[model samples]
Target chain A: MSKLRPTNRSILRRLALFAGLTCFVAIVMFPFYWQLVTSISPPGQLTQLTLIPDLNNASTDAYFFIFRERNFGRYLYNSFGVASLSTLFGISIASFSAYAIARMSFPGKALLLGLVLSIAMFPQIAIISPIFLFMRDMGLRNTWLGLIIPYMTFSLPLSMWYLTAFFKTIPDSLEDAARIDGCTPIQAFSKVIFPLALPGVFTAAILTFIYAWNEYLFALTINTQDAARTMPVGITMFQGEYTLPWVETSAAVVSVTVPLAIVVLIFQQRIISGATAGAVKE
Target chain B: MEIRKTDGSRLRKGLSERQTAYALILPAMLVIFAVAVFPLLQTFYISLFDLRLNHPTRNARHFVHKLNLEQYVDMTDRGRSALASLSDSDVSDDVLRRLPAIGETLDRLHDTLVSNPDRLDQYERVRDLVVTFEPVRESSLRYFRISGLEANEALSLAEQLQDDVARAIAATRESPSRQLRVLEQISQDVGRSIVYPNFIGLGHYAAHFADTRLWSSLINTMTFVGFAVLFELVFGMLIALLINRKFLGRGAIRATVLIPWSIPAAVSALIWRYMYDGQFGIVARALDAVGLIGDSSVMLSTGSGAMVSLIVADIWKTTPFMALLLLGGLQTIDGTLYESARVDGARSYQQFFRITLPLLKNTMMVAIIFRSLDTFKVFDLVYVLTAGGPANATETLSVFAYRLMFRQMNFGSGSAVAVVVFICITLLSVVYVKALDSDMLTGHK
Candidate 1:
């Protein structure tokens, strides 16, 4: 009876703590939830300030406006193209470099590792001038290549670093076994290690994609023309020289961000693990 | 001859192994060299030249050739000839050798007069040079009459020599001013002409270090990062510890806390900007209700208020991230450590200090570094919230660099600012890496 009484009291205390946490979480989530609601709420009712949109007032006018009036589809396509290319190119290069750092007994491996990691720490603003000049000279400005090239600089370092960590966790014995079977280094990496490191590759790919997608400074600086503007750059158009359309802007924000949120939700576990693993040892 | 077949096979295998290794690492190295290192070298090269696109004549081969050492010697000879023609007496090499020393003495005298206005009459030579240089140009005929030296007779050659000396001093003063004006004009023109040029130098960095505006912006950035990180660490730790125990619907609560972290930073910034808007936002309404602020309070209009609002928004968005990291660290601690502390008759506070704080150091450091770096380069939130406005009170180094590079088209200074930020972050990164290394080595064993 004494044990039961204490257990009952602890259960009630646990319930109270859970309720408090739920409230805290709701407060944390309110901004995103409000953004979603504001995106779908009818234009006239957007300012009503309700938690949920009235069923009769719900509409897709803001999204429709973004598509027809704002040329948002083009921006989305540009964002997808640049982000996809950067992620693809970044991962391919990082995978090889990561392999070299993790497995090869190179003379300057420590210096190379330190240099690569240092690149990740640099702020893009500092290198903007020289990068802009280089882009202009190469005839890359106002083109997708201008944005993609610099975006690679940011993502490649991160990909190389994280992928290096992931590659280190894999035992060398696996690679040796393949070599013993007369498989060359390339074949061994492809046939044996590559398949095993898919999760890590996936993690790197997602991170690279997200970083490129959300990157604003390089995109804003390099690509001034609308044809090559990414989603984040496109959103800046809502703040006109004299006026800001808050409602339509919120709607546009929802459109681009929802897809990212969905991706995060789907791959939450992998992302959490990858993020913590990279961070914990830093 | 018997082992020849085995030897050939071994040689082929060795060659193939080298080739495979090269193929694996070559592409990444090439990309890094082309994209990162090449531009850095190119920027360094450009900074060495006095290249400005605005000087149309200077763009020609003749002007470029004229900048050589031979042309500079020719200009010096011509200046000497001009002074000699006015004096009507050939100045000897001995006098020319003493000219620089005499000029330095005159400059010191002038500086003393300028600093103390009462000392003006004490420096007669400098005063004569300043007064007569322009009048001598206007009244070339009167130059000899005023000094009582006949123009044709060149009477009292020493007085004519004094005139030459004054002219030389005047020319020296005017030459630097003229060069400065020309340089300024060229820079202004270049600023207007270049679309985007890779300019690399420390000029902007020096200017920023000297300017009070840059210091103020840096202080604001540090203030924002320091307060936000400090508060987030404390609040996030408390929240994480509170929810560490098993609870009903804990999963739901944890998922909800992740919403802010999951939301795009840009969108959240915009949302908070709206919430803090004075015209009819939730923050203003709540503050009014509590009588803490007036109904007409514009949270973002005032400098302190805007800073506080920015800090609040950042804390809201990032506390979840801090909590998540701390929660992960909390889970790693052995519960038996706490049990033992309690068995030793320690209070709850003592147990937390003894068992929890020391164990959580590594996780806390990681969180602080990440958060501090993110806050250091804060652009999206500040850009969306204030645009570094209300008289440029909140302009961070990044924002200032952007305005210089994009708005004013001053790539040189902008590049310099970028270098400063890079150096600062690099130093921070070194500290972080050292701390992490020590933490890992200590914690693992």
Candidate 2:
């Protein structure tokens, strides 16, 4: 094929592909670059029309302002606490259900799976107000549990799906052999299959944690008080508070996103696989 | 493939595995029911009645005609005492003759509260709280909700007494004393005893159907979904094909591609918002230089510009995930099919059309429909970026519902908007389910 085509034309084609890929990569990355630049830029330089970033003059004052004056430290603490608890709860509950769905053939197994799929996709807006009402009635408003329960439950569908697919990939013979060794079903599962399914559980927990960490609507509605507000809601509140510098918003966003970005980068393979787990059966 | 899942479990079912399975799944199902399903049902129920949190009397769902005894008792009592203390010089002879009737009317109303065996004790407790100046925050104690005939009579009587005070105050303007003025002021302060029935059956739904805002948002939502999914599918397919090819730095490239999808949506919105800033946004300036946009500010400052900006941001953020979905489909295509086609002397483009495109159709369809559904319920991005701003020209249904429920405190209308969204999504889901009636759904082999 190289011999058939002219050398000049082939070079042009190669150059075009390289440029397209470079442009795509640039498009994917420029926002974060802009975010970093904006976060580091001081209030005086925020409105400057310079396209290039100024790193030497960068300041951490915006970060300090958010932590000190805006109570973003509380929001960060709240987000971490809620996301961790939600992941823990989601992982624990999903393990058993995933095991059952993957292992046994219950009567309503098909029906249950269908229901789970839809519930996983249930729109949060539909339930936001009712949950608010229930939270108020249960005295859960501005409480950690108010946000935790919804986050954990909403994540159940995906967690269960991935865990089920993960559990399915594990052979049943291990547990069968454990049963033959005089172990009960629970004991066999704990000793044999659970160990094999640990990776799936971890992956499910990562996804769930990300889901909880990124969540804003429930956090905003349920946790109205500064004591319980999460990072996403707290940062949005930064605006309309005496017309502060736009740099503060950038600082808050970078602080929240960088950790998640780092984690996702490290676990990119597992996260990617977990997302496409059962969706592509082939 | 695993017939043992049926026969094997049945043969070794000594430990009640069915019961165990149910028990294991019970907690997850219960949580889902409580958090999602129950609240969703409750939202539907709330949408039937007017639940405006900002409105004092209509904050909660009212089941019957109710009296606000706290305000009623205090104001009526003040009116009667103020009228009785009036001097002879303060009013005309006719008004003096009418004073006893109005006083008796007030006492009778008070006597009803004090005399009723069911309400007398509760009324006294409420009176004590009012006198001590404590806020009756609890609705159960403050609002006297009843379905009895007394509810109607008390409501009418309160109105009549208020009217009488007005008449007396107007009639004695010539002798204007502070006593009658106090009575008039108290009567004016006394609110209606009849609590409003906020139950508007299908009223919100009907009103929304007629609302232009809802239609505009629906248009915005569909436009965003349509354009986002379309561009995502096409570009995602191209990216998937490119990355799926053998490359040296493929792992690094894949990780780079996953950045947008990995970052939380709200953070993505903020990043885009900064870059699309009218005056200082780099991307805006770039677009202006390329003549893609007339100006940098128009993207967030105009309706068409905002919509286009939203679609572009969505495409940028989600095309990576879309590519991943398609890549999953791409990997499933047997490699030998391409080798065999090459042996048949088929060109690369021909092989792609014959071997790859046909096989990738299912994943493409499913990814598009699923992506469409996700885009339909977008709130965080639109909310954080523009907040349906630039005069709310960018408001989608979810944004509209958020404003109605949380911002406007109209849960009823908001829930109505929610239910409308639910119905639309459920319809789309049914289509998704129909498309997914394959072996993957059954999970057998």
Q: Against the true structure, what is each candidate's TM-score? A: 0.75, 0.90
Query: What lDDT does the true structure give each of the candidates?
Result: 0.67, 0.82
Task: Give lDDT tens digits, candidate 1, residues B1-445.
Answer: 1122577886776666556556666777677667666665544443333333334322211211111112222223233344334234444444354345433432332242223433333223333543444321222221111111121122222233344344444444223333223322322332111112223245445666899877887888888889999999998998889868775666555655665665556667788876776763667667867887766365777788788888999999888778878888999999898888878899878978988989898889988998898789887778767878767777787887677667766555555555666667878888888988987898899
Q: Which of the CAPRI classes, incorrect, acceptable, medium or high, describes model 2?
A: medium
Question: Which pairs, if any, clash in model 2?
Answer: none
Off by over 4 Å in 2: A1-14, A241-244, B1-15, B78-98, B107-156, B171-182, B189-191, B436-445
Worst 10 residues of 2 chain B by lDDT: B1-10
For model 1, the stretches where C-alpha displacement exceeds 4 angstroms are A1-12, A44-48, B1-23, B37-203, B246-259, B295-297, B345-347, B433-445
The positional error of residue B254 in candidate 2, measured at the CA in angstroms, is 1.0
- Native-to-model Cα distance after best TM-score fit, residue A41 in candidate 2, in Å: 2.5
lDDT of 2 by residue, B298-366 (tens): 888998988888998999999999999999999999999999999999988999899899889778877
Q: For each candidate, give the interface RMSD after superposing the true interface residues on Cα.
A: 4.4, 2.5
